[model samples]
Target chain A: MKAQSDNLVEAALETLKASTLRVTEPRRALLRLLAEAEKPLSCEEIRARSEGEFDLVTVYRNMEVFREQNIVQTILLESGKQLFELTVEGDHHHHIICRSCHRTLRLELCFGGELERYASSRGFKQLEHKIEVFGLCETCSED
Target chain B: MKAQSDNLVEAALETLKASTLRVTEPRRALLRLLAEAEKPLSCEEIRARSEGEFDLVTVYRNMEVFREQNIVQTILLESGKQLFELTVEGDHHHHIICRSCHRTLRLELCFGGELERYASSRGFKQLEHKIEVFGLCETCSED
Candidate 1:
């Protein structure tokens, strides 16, 4: 587990360098937190893990900057709080949030491939797509 | 346009009735606002359309109630504001948001069909998915 976490932090550091973002301590820690998250995290949760080593304002600032640079992606939870996660290695995917357990799962589907073609046909160029599905998970399904 | 809007409101009211939620003036207005919205709206926007007839507290309270009854669904936009939209008539879909113009197009696909099968084969169950793609619209791309 420790090795996996260490690798995640290291990879995140590399992402920052590759994106022209400065390697500040707060930024580094923020990236590490995002990379390690099993699901998306709100800004408050991100700050809590830092043990007051960084200010809340700093976390917000760096997160906005990193998102602008495309180094991080925002995941929305059912609770209406925006959570941050590292952009996936390649290609893009969407999320499935469990209505019962509130658990989140990543679903990779080019399902929107058809939608893109449709848009292009309509002369709506430069199209982008985002999809979210909500329902009972297996555990909640039984209950 | 007004006739179409009224029909939408009527359809939404039927949904509320099926859920056994009592229809009141505020609830009716809220549903109408969501039905008319081309995209999800912030709480403030919902209140604005209510023309000061309903207070913010009422909007928040009714939204919570509506969400619990599955009469509405919420999304956290990239802008970090929580937006509410009417769930489609008896189906789930995603959104394609134009970052430049903030226009949102509804998207429908097979609801995690094959992917859910794959995940189930791997011992994963209770999946939920949300997908959002961000990019410039045709006009923004041309600009």
Candidate 2:
């Protein structure tokens, strides 16, 4: 696990360099956190998990930079919350979030190609799709 | 068009009563706006179109009430903004928004049923899906 994590950090650092972004400590740490996260995390969730290492505004600023560099992607939930995750190349995916617990799960399924084609047919160009599924997790449903 | 709009207001009033919410002028005007709209609107957009009739804080408060009653649904965009639209029964749909013009068009196509089944197979219950397609409109693309 440690070795895998190290590789993730290494790759993230390379990503920053490739995007011509300065590799600051906070940026490195935020990248590692997103890279290692099981699911996309909101700004608040990221701050809480950072253990006081980073302030909220700093995190938000770094996230905006990361977004511009395509190092991270933002996922918007129906609840008007934004979640961020590392943008791994060749691994396009979506998310399924538990409405009760707000736990997000990565989804491998993608139908963007077809959806994009449909949008293009309708005279829309540069199509990007956001697909989010909300549900009750097993524990929440049981409760 | 006038008759259709009148029916929309009537339906909206009925919706408010059905939810046991008090019908007021501001609420009625807001509902009329949503009913006549071509797409989901953000609070800022709503205020701008209100022609200085509704205060920003009053709009926010009324929106909260509308959401609680399920009269209006919120759509979160990748830009970290929230959009609101009326919730019409049995007419489930999504949207394709132009990032440049911020114009939204109703998408009649839906694949939520298939997605819900997939989530159920993965142990998720009470699944709801949100799909938003973003891009440039024809005019915006030409520009």
Candidate 3:
């Protein structure tokens, strides 16, 4: 899994609290669902996996909040759809997403830190980078 | 410049026609503008730089069409804003966007081709990856 589930729930809640965000039940439930998920999930998928207490809009809003708090990392598909995964503390990696099935595979590889440094030299502060891979997976490729 | 201006206007128009899309005047105008721009531009910026022949909606629709045809690249910023650039024929590169100024810089560095190969070995077909760097640029960092 890209993100480790162990202690993810506790760590995620702690992160929200540290960010001064409210620890509402819905937020807690969202965090728990993401922590247990083996892969990133869309807002629709998140809502389906969630209790009926939260609606689609709530899922979207909460996900956005979580993203800003660094509690979740979002993978943007070529079609502009996004999938959210819980962030394991201090773990930074990319993902390979199947275009057909939308299944995700965690990739341990990341662009080197030199990239951030390169931007730093260009006078950029608070530098960051994002990468996502996309393609047809085995089963879909055979079809 | 990532996209070469030499013959770009003619080439872009021909591309549209070859793709069976209409070679409208607005499209021609946009092609000329982007071919001349040293950097990417947002839709609003594109319209502002336009000849007043096309509205913002026209620029938006045309840019989306260009993206689908691989004639343009869209960089999604952390704030969800997108910057669009004309693609030079056979030219592929990423960008480093400044968070404060919303400006962009072309980066010659790309993740190695081994990434696609790695995904291919993992049973992925037609593999592709996207990378973009983000940070505060010098002017913004000092602000």
Q: Which candidate number has the best lDDT?
A: 2
Task: Please state the error at residue B5 of candidate 2 in Å.
Answer: 2.9
Residues B50-103, model 2: lDDT tens digits: 887979887889888887777788887767788899887787888888989888
Question: In model 1, how large is the Cα lDDT of residue B1?
Answer: 72
Most accurate candidate by DockQ: 2
Q: Which ten residues in a row have the lowest lDDT in candidate 1 chain A?
A: A121-130
Candidate 2 C-alpha lDDT tens digits along A6-101 = 676787788778876788989878877887787788888888888879899989998898877777888876666788988877888888899988
Task: For candidate 1, write residues B39-135 as lDDT tens digits.
Answer: 7887898999888998999999988887776667776666656778876565686666667776666655444676666556534555545555555
Compared with the true structure, what per-residue lDDT tens digits does model 1 show for residues A61-114? 988887776767776666656767777566487666666666677766566787
| Candidates arranged by DockQ, highest first | 2, 3, 1
Clashes of each: 19, 0, 2
Candidate 3 similarity to native, TM-score: 0.86
The C-alpha local distance difference test score for the whole of candidate 2 amounts to 0.83
* Residue-level lDDT for B75 in candidate 1: 65
**DockQ metric for all predictions:** 0.44, 0.72, 0.64
Shift in Å, residue B25, candidate 2: 1.9
**Ten-residue region with minimum lDDT total, candidate 1 chain B:** B121-130
lDDT of 3 by residue, B35-104 (tens): 8887888899899998567799999999999988888888777756677888876688888888788788
